[model samples]
Each structure stands twice: as C-alpha cells, then as structure tokens.
Target chain A: MKQACSIPARAGIGLKPSHYRDALDSVGTIAWFEVHAENYMGAGGAPHVWLERLRSNFPFSLHGVGLSLGGAEALDQEHLANLRTLIDRYEPGLVSEHLAWCRRDGLFFNDLLPLPLNEESLDVVARHVEQTQEALGRRILVENPSSYFAFESSTLEEPEFLSELCERSGCGLLLDINNVYVSACNNDFDAETYLGKIKAEQVGEIHLAGHAVEHLEDGETLRIDDHGSHVCDAVWGLFEKFAGRCTGVPVLVEWDTNVPSLSVMLEEASKADRILTQVSSH
Target chain B: MQNGDGDTLGKIVGDDSKFSRRFSVYRNNVYHSLTVALSDAYPVVKRLVGDDFFLAMARTYLDGGGFPVHAPLYDFGKDFPDFITGFAPAESLPWLGDVGRIERAWLQAYHGADAESGGMNLEALSSGDAERISGLRLVFHPSLCIEQLSWGAFEVWEARGGEGVAGMKVEARKNFIVAARGMDGDVRVGSFGEGVFDFFERLHNGKGIMAAAGDMDVSVVGEVLGGLVRLGAVIGVEE
Candidate 1:
C-alpha cells in the first residue's frame, strides 16, 4: 500500500495526459497534482498506468465532476462505488465534488447545472453530501460552482448556502476564487463581500481558472467558466488578496480546455506559489 | 429544470430577455461539453464526416433524447456507432458507421481491464499431451475485441494516422479487424483474414483448440494460434 500523504499548502496543476511526461520529470517543481476523478474511473488503461507512475512522485487529489451531489434525486450508487474503488487504489490526499447538479431523473447533462439556494434544496444537498461522505468513508470538500444566472426562488445568498452546507454536512469548502469572481460579476454582487462570508477555516483548498467573456447584444457582459486560458488579471488579484487568509490551503491551477504546454502550466502554478509564499511569510 | 419541465425554474432566473439569454448559457454548456465528449470518443468518424456534419449529427443525436444516462462521460456514447448507422444524413457514407464502430472498439479495448501478468505458456503447450492440449480452453485478454464489419472500416481507421481519406475509396468489402491492448499498454488495431478471425472468435467464445479449429486446415490453425500467442492475446489455458 502507498503511504498516506497530505496535500501541502502549495500550488499544483490539474494533471492532463498531454503533460504526463513533463509532469513526471518535474515532480518537485510543482507542489502536487489534481485530476478529474471520472477520467480515471476506467477499469484499466493508460490513465491508470500514468496516474500510478505519477502518484509515486507527487501527492495527488481526486476532484470529481459528476457526483451531482446537489441533485433532487437519489445519488447514483454505482458512481459512488466506482469513486470508492478509485480512492482505495490511488489514495489521493484530497477528494472533492461540485456544489451543483449535473443529472436529473436519470439523464446526466454533463455540465454543472446551477441549483436553487432555498431551504428545501439545501436539505437535499446536505443529505447527499452526508451520504457521500458516509459511503466513501472520507470527508470531501464541496466546490462553489460558477453560474451564469441566479434562481429567483433562492432564499439565501451563495455564501450563506455554502456555509449552511458545511455546517449541516460537516464537509469542507473548496473556495474557487475564479468562480467567485465570475459569479459576482454575473449576479451583480461584490466578490470580496462574498469571500468575507465564507468561513476560512472550513476552506480546505482553493481553485484558480480562466473564464471567457462574452458581450451580449443588449450591452450585457457574461463570463463563462471555460477554464481554457491563463488566469486573468482580476482573478489573480482576488487570489492574491484571499491567499493571506487561507495561509496553507492547497491551491490548484485548472485548465481543462485548450490546454497549453507543461511549462506554461508550471508557470501558472509558480504564480500561485509566489503569492502563497509571500502571504505565509508575513 | 434539467428535464425542461416548464418555465417555473426559468422564471426564477428572470423574466427579462437578458435573463433568458443567461439561462441559455447552461443549455449551451451542456450541449458543448457532451458534444466534445462524443467527438473525443469518435475522432475517426468526426475526421471522416468533417466537423460541420459531425456537429449536426451529434446535435440531432442529443436532441432525440440520446443523452448519457450516467456520469463519467468516458462510458457515454457507447451507442453512437449504432446511432450513426440509422442516421439519415450519414446514409451517403455507409462506411462511416463501421469506422465509428472500429474507433469505439479501439477505445473500449484501450480502457478495458489489464491483461493477466503472464503470456501464453509455450512450454505448457509443447509439454502437455496432445489430447489435453486439444481440449484446453484459451483465456484471451480482456482488451481483445474482434469486429467482423461489413465495410472496410479498418482501412479508414488506419488512414486517420496516415494520408487521411482525401483521395481514398471506401469499398463495401467484409473487413475482419482486431483491437487489443498490447503488452506495451498501447491499443493496436489490425486487420486479419477470415480464417484467423473466426478461429479467435471461437476461442473467445470458450471453445477449445480442437473445437475452435473446426474444419479448418491444421496448419492454418497452428499459424493463427502462433499469431495470437505473439500478440499476447492468449493469457492462459483452462481445462
């Protein structure tokens, strides 16, 4: 069995197949790595082979994209079982899922669909989170999803919903700074105010990614969480400010679409590491 | 909301046109991500049909209630090949569906279970009594897949790695293709003759050496079995 290791309070890159060779070569250069759990759920293949090779070199985290923890229906038991199997096999330092639903009535939409932040919906998500933690036998961090629009039925603010979820389910928070920036922009809220509402102690990890800006016909601007390019200037400012509060939280630089070279990804990681270093030294 | 039940959820977002545009973002994201997953799974098919046609066909497939029923998009789109077979727009290129099948088989084999540690024990084959050897059942690797397609899908699939389908003709000939992960952990797609394909198919279905051989020439069966051994497809011999 592999030895138990914790994700250090440092910056890491989301591991992609294109950079497996370079990642293996520059293990110590990057603090750690995170992977979408569904990508590695296959029985056996190159994914598992490279993950095994890389796991030995760097601490790893399993970030899930399909759990649909906030869905209205019962959780998919088979997916939970597959996740358990992967957790046992890989033994990642941290495991997480989104604060949004991807499936409903047995049809998976493949996108993180926003959920209404009301008491009833809150009950459903809290129960699901507890059930997932119980089933996996590990406490998981729930991420705040980026939304294009808000539901009027929502009775609570985004941070309030996440705070109540952590309190009720006993789970940690994966404060995605870019998502905060994106949501704040779209919903016409202050990003720093939203950040202030989050209980920093419950934040186990931080995520930084890029978003695409679109100009609407009626002079409205929309930011889509595409994670395709470099971390923008505003998001970096948010991370730089938030880094001081969450001193040792492991930060991940996520680039899922239009993935660049390993050196580029490492440069992104180094950027976060520099802020983290300055904050911790103070 | 996910089921598109009504405007109750939609109204909650907002009643304004700008809000409707924002709501469409979720719809667009769902469609875009699922389409990307299908494209990844059926690259050769996409390459053959070109992006515009492929996107149209994929949108049609999704619009007709063909969305994935579960998570981990890797397991999604298993029926895309079959969906292409009956798709109206793709009828002109009948061979395209078979190429999709070959690509899907290649992906399945790539993600299938790892083979057992050892390869075929040649010593056991040589040392065992003739009767015992003839009655022994072969255990093939989990990743081995044999497709007896009605089109030259193998050529088209191979072309994706070469000059592509620019000036090539896709003949409607019977193609016996095998997709399996080799010992080096790379999934290889190869074409074979009818006799070899049939022999392996029989062995795959739990037939012993003599039973799988059927009425074929003994020499031909020996040569085919040697090829299977070399491919590392035969993992063990079961009594």
Candidate 2:
C-alpha cells in the first residue's frame, strides 16, 4: 500500500482517543494525525478501528515511544517486529522513534529514558537504526529526546551525535522542537545554537508540544516534555526559527494528557498552521 | 560475570552491592510503570479491590511472574485472572477470578473493532418464524465476549463499595454473561439462559440459526432472540 500521509507544509494534531470520533467527524483540511505506535499494537480494538477510519480521510504518522533504540545491549528484535507489523498494516506517511533507551537485560521501562552520546552508544544506535530501516524497507526518522541530565561519560554534543547517525545510517531526523527547548533549559544551553547545528536536510518532520517545569537542586530547573497543554511562547518562537529553514516539513502538535475537546485541539493545530503559513509565505 | 557470551541473571544484575542496588531501582521502575499501565487498563478491577490491595496483589504478581515478552501495555493482563486463581490471598475470594473474566471481557469489548455480526437477520426472517428460530446458529459480533461463571460474577463485578457479603449468597448461581459493542460505539452487558447459550455456541460454530437453536423452548428463546436483534448484536442470518 502507498504511504497514507505526507507532510504538505501544513499542521496536524496528535491523535488522542478522546477526540477520535470528533476527529473523524471533522478531518477535512486538518493536514494529518500522528499517533503513538505502541497504543495501536493490538490484534483489533478501538484504537485500530478508529485509526482505520481516520486513515481513510487523513494520512497518519506513527511516532513510536518504545523500541529502546539506543540501549547498551543489542536492540529488541520483538519490538522491531511489532513496528514492522504496524507499518505494514497502516502504511503510515511517516515513521519515527526517539533516540533513547528504555530497556536493559530484556526488561522494559516503557519510558523514553535518555542515552549518553558516546562512540560505543552511537555505534549501537546506528546498527539498530540500519536494521530497523531495512526491516521496514523505508526511511525512518530518529527524534531527539527530552533529557533531564547529561552523562559525564559522553563526549559529543546531542546535535553532532544525531547528525552523525543520519549520515551513517542514511535515516531522517524528526526535529522535536519542544524536546530541544526542554533539554536546553534543563542543561543551560542556547536552543537556537543547538538548532543551528543540526543538518536541516536530514529532518523529515518536526514536533511541537507543551512541557511542565520541575525544580531541582542548586536552583536548576528541568522542563519535562509533558505534552499535556497549550504550546508555550518560547517553544513556539524556537519552532518559528526552525520552520523558516525546514519550510515544507509536516509539523505535529503532540498532546498526550489532559486532552481538551476536538475544537480545542483544532485550535492548537490552527496555531501551528498559522506559523507554518507565515514562514512559507516569507 | 560472563561477557561476550550466554550469561545468567546474576551476570546481568552483577555481584557488586551498588550494582545490585541500582538494578533494584531499575527493576522497581519497570514494575511500577507496568502496574500503573495495568491499573489504567483495568480501572474497574482496581476499584473492585481497593488501591492498596490491588497494588499489593500486583506486587505479588510481579514477584511471581513478569509480563509477556514485548507485549503492549494494553495486552499486559491476559493471564491476570489465571494468576488470581493461584494467588494464596486471593484464593478465599472465589469470585475474584470471575470478576477478572468480566474485566478481561470488558477490555476486549472496549478495544475490539466494529464488525458486522453474521448471525440471524431479524428483518429477513418471517415474523412468524422468529419464535420458532430456536437452535438457530447464533453468531455474535467479533467484540462480544461470553463467560460462564460458577457464582454471582456479574453482580460482584458490577457491585460497588464495601458491601458486606460473606460466602455463598442468594446470587451464587451459575450465570451466562455476554458483553458486546454496538454500531454506535456503545458497549453493553447482558445475560442468557441455557437455550440461548446453546444457540450461541452453535452459531459461533458456524451453524445457521435454524440449525443451532433448533431444539430449545420456542417462546422463551424467541424473547432472547428479539432482544439480541433489538440490541443489534446479530448482523445477518443465513437461510
């Protein structure tokens, strides 16, 4: 089957269960919907059912949260197989996974934990990305994760590490602008300089979301990528900067919790659309 | 610790005291995350057995057994009912397993896709033959889950709060339950009798309505048949 979704330089909302019916009711002019692949990993259910219905109207992107792509040990083959099955079934417009690890010794944490950007870990991640792309027989996008702490053992910066992965594996980048803001704020880095270093051509898609702040030791603040509320001012400013460079990429608004009504989500999507339109028009 | 080859759990966890402590932290994280996922998936089950008891039961379940390899969070609790059966503390709560059955069925119904049930078509069949349609093969929607319980499982499952009930009560009788979703996305639970169960069994076995419910009480079976039709539980009836 042909890929069902394509990024037409437009904005789309992250699909949630609460808005499935209303989304189906009003999918017109709404660029596409993105979903967490793990949520639909079932034989048959409402997620799969509504996904099928929504796919008929709008193209979709499968943003995976599991897979532990950057683990110390070998990558999880079963997780790859599940991803393959979903890709084959859905034929999504875009397939993306985070550059993080959530498993060790066959035990999975089910959370997108951070990875140290080092030679050993980079090699492991590249091999897994190559195998995953080969398994799906398609180009996959690697998303930058929101990290709380930087490992002292790492040598390369996050942008350089991601750029190298794209170069070595021939995979695409999923530029999560919210993640960049969250990580930069937590680690005291300039988000704009970090975005400037990333190879723009390698980015296949972009993500924007809301984050929660947590206070840590020594007056340090950590911005958690909660994706449960409206788009913040700072993240939107950073997104506008990136959108200028990557003009045609599809931008998805991710809201995983405290999801509002369908119209409320649409309002968020409209905000993204306005930004993309303004950037492209210039 | 073995490196670059097959190893044991000790090799993975390590022999160092700090490594063991760190491993425990990671293990606790995984177990707690999965328990929260299960709690979300089975809220009714969590409510049935208060939060503390449920967490304690979940901790014991994890201690005894882990989830299936690489299964999604939604499909994590398929074996929970069976685990509840063998659990020492839950053994006295005989209805617990049955409640689990209901929870599992509810989960299935909640997630299963909408499909046209190829059973009896009430509109096509002559109105006069509807009552005589006993033993007609009954095909339920793919979402329908029926379970036969030893006691008042349906009641115990739907029961709320700390109600006082000691052993066998007035409702501790064998019951047949069906949970199915309708075309409009509304889910429902209903009960059936021996005749209806026999008919459903036959239909699920690919028999037509006439062939399945052929030997039952004509009038009582007719009532159940009309109810199924009104509920949109039956999609089509083969002649």
Give a tens-digit lDDT track for model 2, residues B1-239: 11212222223212354334433433554666778877776566677678998898887776665553463665677778778767787766766776787777777776776674444464555446654443345556777777776667666666532364334253556777777776656667766654477766766678766666566666665677666766556666554
DockQ of each: 0.74, 0.22
TM-scores for the candidates: 0.94, 0.79
| Each model's chain A TM-score | 0.97, 0.95
Expressed as tens digits, the lDDT of each residue in A81-181 for candidate 1 is 99999999999999999999888778998889888899999999999999999989888999999988888788999899999999999888999999999
- Candidate 1: residue B215 lDDT (0-100): 85
Write one digit per residue (lDDT tens) for candidate 2, span A102-202: 76666566777666688888899999989888888888899998865566567889999999999999888999999999889866789999999988888
True contacts kept of 1: 0.86
